[model samples]
Target chain A: MANERMLMKGNEALAEAAVRAGCKCYFGYPITPQTEIAAYMSKRMPKCGGVFLQAESEIAAINMVYGAAATGVRAMTSSSSPGISLKSEGISYAAGCDLPCVVVNVQRGGPGLGGIQPAQSDYYLATKAGGHGDFYIPVYAPCSVQEMADYAVKAFDMADKFRTPVMILSDGLLGQMMEPVVFPEITDNEPEKDWACTGHGNKRRHNIINSLYLKPEELEESNRERFKKYEIEKAELPEVETYLTEDAEIVVTGYGASARIVRSAVNAARAEGIKAGMIRPITLWPFPEKAYAETVETAKAYLVVELSMGQMVDDVRLATSCKRPVRFFGRTGGVIHTPAEILAQIKLIAKEELK
Target chain B: MKRITVIAGHYGSGKSTFAANYAIDMAARGEAVTVVDMDTVNPYYRTADLGDIFEKNGVKLAAPRYAGTNLDVPILDFDIPGLYAEGRNLVIDLGGDDAGAYPLGKFRQFIGLHKNECDILYVVNFCRFLTHNAEEAEEILREIERACGLSATGIVNNSNLGFETDSEIIGSGRLKAEKISALTGLPIFCHTLPDIPSCEGIDREGYYPLTVYIKNVWN
Candidate 1:
């Protein structure tokens, strides 16, 4: 059947898609760039027969998500940069407890409450260490409205399938922008919640959801089990979109909104007889390492672009194992780089490296 | 035809989105269109963000001087007044709330000089706060009108729930639009749908099919 098309902002699309994905509860606090998600959920959750609560703080909101997810219901919480910092402890706890939940970090400029503008500076925070732990949550960085809607549903499923938290890492640009989106039909076969904490019904044993493990050996075992799931995810869930990568000499790579700019820059470079391509990471944590490895076969040099000060460049370097000269271009503290700026950079890179 | 249109509403009411689409539509119709971004209140979601989209469609943009720059200050371009000349269609995307509408007071003289050819449209989204009902919507409308020193000529019902909007919600918004019209004595200029002729309960004349331009990378 044909999907339904609608015009929606990124935050609102994420919220609505979560509800349609059979998400039963939403817990979020108000923060700029992402406040629309909570506001959208306020009006939509009630109508969908779901729970929507504005918690006292971002800490409370993510903890509420923990509580809801412990019960095996599709639960989520959204926040911006500083707010996500507040949610880190609970995110770590949810990760520790092996509870499934979706966390949306519609990132803003920040090392502090920097600004209410878009930035991808949260790359390390999301990929390396979102909280005080060694656990990694699969992060989906969408570059369009359609992906935002599609990833919301996919994030929930990935969370449940692995019994771990999954993040939809977006920025202010994606959160506030409006676009036409076609939503897929709601899935009919929701996975059964056999391990839910539903009062320990007569047929099943009591399920204890806790993160604490005084025993190092038990914690080590738990960590090992989680890593096994991560290994599976690495093989199965690394997503990237390659644009004009075939027989190209310069490859530009980025994620989220920066990737969108890179696409335009690559196209403009191609129009001017420069063989430019792009590798857009759809999943930031898994990092799409193989895609970079494959691109390196034809591409001579790579330019890593972002809205932050070269955070994802490290990942790209590692993905290619520093086989080629991987350079970086970005702006921090809420500054957005235009396509013209990126195109100029690409032209310069081609002249310098293609020699 | 010469026209000066102002789109104003509360934050999250989709006024910027509507203005962007309206400008694109007019430009596609072969009119010499210029869109002014008077939205200093919202630094992120504004017509300024879609300068490339407007330029690609042959629509001229008159945004803040510091637009697309790092600074978040409101610095209107000197050429804004030139956009109001005869025989060109101009769209002014006003900021949300009364504070956002205050910028329009600067253009009061220009609007008054061309009052017969000008229209200030109060875009309403029934799903947004402070405009969920007729009473609340009218209150905000009065505040915007008082700030701009011009009354709303008509109401554009751009009610939506993002991706969840349907015919039932669109049909329900018509009642709220009628109520808003009743309270303010304004005609329902049009109802906006994401796709035209495909959605039920919307007829041809009073409905506009919109192509949403100002969108982020995600939906």
Candidate 2:
């Protein structure tokens, strides 16, 4: 038996989920659309004997998260679009060192000083390697508050499980939206701190955490090992929800908030005699490329829609390998896609799809 | 186009303040000059506080977009597209020590592709470490040269008496310039002028040279 329903905002659920995931260290600053996360952590962390630091800046906050994660403690940070750009360097370092830290981006409009409103413009920065050099970060996108809570817990486990940095690729709407969520119970058994920097208390030797493999061959070997981890990750990580695809000829795909919009369009498209289905990605990084390809094999066409102007579509297209007609419709810089608008495109694509 | 002259010094030195005021003096001279505070290490006295003043002087400012400046956060990507492509000079005020400036390593790949149009200057205070002696100065020059994968062609000798200037900005500066000259064989481009020059401080670095037009100069 489990507690089935509780009202929660997406941001609030993420914060609570991190706690349930055994994350006791939270370092973050207050920013739009995701402020609720920091606020919730501030209140809950204190009572739970956890560490919560409201850092002076987004840069400092991310570093604080880095420092805690370095100690092998479950640590996290949350910010919006502009703030995410500031944290890219740290995120890159985290990947370079293979540290487990959870970073959440309630994306907003961008390029520079993008608005505080909701947008998925950070798709490129998150899914693709945003930082310099070559290392892959596991990115998770949660379209609903329920997934936000579940992913929050899973993000920490995945990070610890894979020894990699994981990002919750969210948007302001998902972050701010309120919905009924049933969170998992806090577990008694925490992961072992075999690799963390927490002092061994006169153990065998001192622990040094660094990404500097000075020797060319040594660094290259380390990079190769990281890629090996990524290869295994790709096999195990696939998150998606499909609807009404038994004989659908066209598919509408999206994630985070846009996925919600695509769901509505999917329902309407079906009513209009358009054989349209919906595909929402739950994990953005270990991107469910297999599911995408499998769905596309029988479908006549695919329609990709997002708030950002065709960023994720690139990944979608690459996954599908141009097997079917893959089209895109998107808005950049703080514009949300509407269900009717997406259905109209779905209708247009289904016309060809039906033929 | 805006102009900026980076003023660098050792840890606990006043170079950042000097760079900040230099931008201020340029603005007073009716020149729009913004101080691009690239100091990633230091927490206080950054060029960020002068954003409004520089803006008023037509001197636009740019710094890491941190809410606070002291944290050791990774430097953000500057998205002012074409700043490096400018035909005018832009000042890149840096933090103390070479390691403080190590972040430019990532951008070196991009900068190298555009080296045909940009200028990079190393600011030195003779009394500081590494630049305090000719041998040390040579080592410092070598580090910046190698780190950026570009030699420091221009030098700014901001030799100061540590808030106790002799009312004359000459002896200390001249010695440092000579050392830089003898060491790198690069020209001592300019030293701090008691009276700052005229130039709006905006535009990204490499656009134009940040110059302090000193009268009665001796070098």
Candidate 3:
């Protein structure tokens, strides 16, 4: 099949990409900002010989995902912030049981059903264990509709490769926005799941999928094994995009939509003779520590921008080990900062640093 | 080409998608096209989201003040009035439902004066809820017209199952469109199909092949 170019919404594209990536089961509940994913799946899944089950709630949806993933079928579930909160317990179980699955959070503002609009306040929740565990799920933040489609497939692949859950952390802007995208040709060469809980035949022993371990030592061993994988992921899976940072005096950093706005801000600042560049972390989990450390060598100061009140700023600080001052600028509760707003912050930083 | 084309329908009727493709089509034919995003009710899918497509195709976009911003406020831009100026081909992508059509009531006087030069199209999709049949579609159409204080000049058959759509589905929609036309006394403006190689077996006039501009992110 040739690559086909089509215009799609971020949420719709994510659903289609999962189907094309051989995802056999989709369990999701409708929520604002992310409802299109469930809607799209409801239409496409059956046609593709896949399961499109809309569970009664987000809690049931994630648990259904767990069941499908335990059977070694590619499975996924998506929700917004409040819905994700409800699914946290199920997500923790999936992580602890070492099941491979993809979870999409088309985030909205929330300390509680804050608003049904774009927000990035789920950074801490997503990067740290969103569920109640010391486990880590590699979170991919996509800036464009194209990347939304790309990352959905990548999340599935990464999840299976590491035998853990992977998250595509998107916001309402990316979830709702549409863009032209070229879909990769579908392939049927997914990795085999040797430990899958298919009925154990005479050739193999039964595979039990459980998060609970009776003994403390056994649970500790499981934690140690997961941490070993996390360390490997930190070394292997960190992804970032840097623009004009070679001789930049000031580097603005952000992820997802904020990164897109920051790129425009950097361009505007450059035209005005301000040496501004950008470092966009594509994978929020690994934090792109090496990229930040390398850019800090040339960049004198950093501006951490987001759609929330400076959640990712902590990671940016730790990435560079506080080598230079990291300033924060953002709006919370569904407020989006414009490129002009970001450029003004960059200009202020340049003035202070150049002096 | 009509001087002003207003595309209106219920939610999920693919009105914004139709307006974007229509504007792009007009621009491709060398017309000076400007698409105004008059959608204030539905925040997610709107013509303003296609700014890049409009820019690339040389079509101007006049959107609401908070069209692409994170704010959920329904503040329309002041430049909206400029879209009604004569000479250029204009496409007005209205919001879904009667509530979405409320803003158009304010422009009723201007539209009424130039009604002959404007085309208010009621786009119908049988696949959508509250419009599964001709009677239901007609009721919603009257509601929208009453809200906007402007009568629909034509009916556009845009019924489909998104990417799952086929020629047979599109052909079946023509019957629903005919019923809507009969009940509303409106002419069939066009029958829309996804832009694919072969829409075989279904021979219908005004077959407008559409390149879907508005889509869910994971299409």
Q: DockQ scores for all the models shown?
A: 0.12, 0.01, 0.10
Candidate 3 lDDT, B1-219, residue by residue in tens = 688899999777889889989999999999998898888776776779789989999998888777765564676765435665646888998888787788989889888888888899999887653476899899889899889889999998998766556676677788989998988799999988876445544454568878876543211
- How do the residues B1-219 of candidate 1 rate in per-residue lDDT, one tens digit apiece? 348898998877888788988989888898988888988776776688888888899988888877755465766665446766545788989887787899889878878888898878999988653466889889889999899888889999998866566777688788999998988799888889865334645554667777766433311
Better of 2 and 3 by DockQ: 3
Q: Write the per-residue lDDT of candidate 2 for residues A1-355, one digit (tens) a residue.
A: 1563544557878898898888989988877768778877886899899998999998898888878888988899999888888888888888888889999998877778756667888888997865878987888899887889998888888898898889999987787654556787766445786878888789658777788887999999999999999999998987788878666688788888888878778888778777788778888887888777888767898888888888878778888887888899987776666788888898787666666
Model 3, B98: alpha-carbon shift in Å?
16
Per model, the share of native interface contacts recovered reads 0.05, 0.00, 0.07
RMSD of each: 7.8, 20.4, 10.0
Off-target runs (Cα >4 Å) in candidate 2 are A1-4, B1-219
Q: By the TM-score metric, which is better: model 2 or model 3?
A: 3
- The candidate that wins on TM-score is 1
Q: Give the TM-score of candidate 1.
A: 0.74
Models ranked on DockQ = 1, 3, 2
- Over A138-200, each residue of candidate 1 has an lDDT whose tens digit, in order, gives 999998777889999999988888888999999988888766677767775457887778796
Which sequence of candidate numbers ranks them by lDDT, best first?
A: 3, 1, 2
> Residue A100 of candidate 2: its Cα lDDT?
92
In DockQ, how does model 2 score against the reference complex?
A: 0.01
TM-score of every model versus the real structure: 0.74, 0.61, 0.71
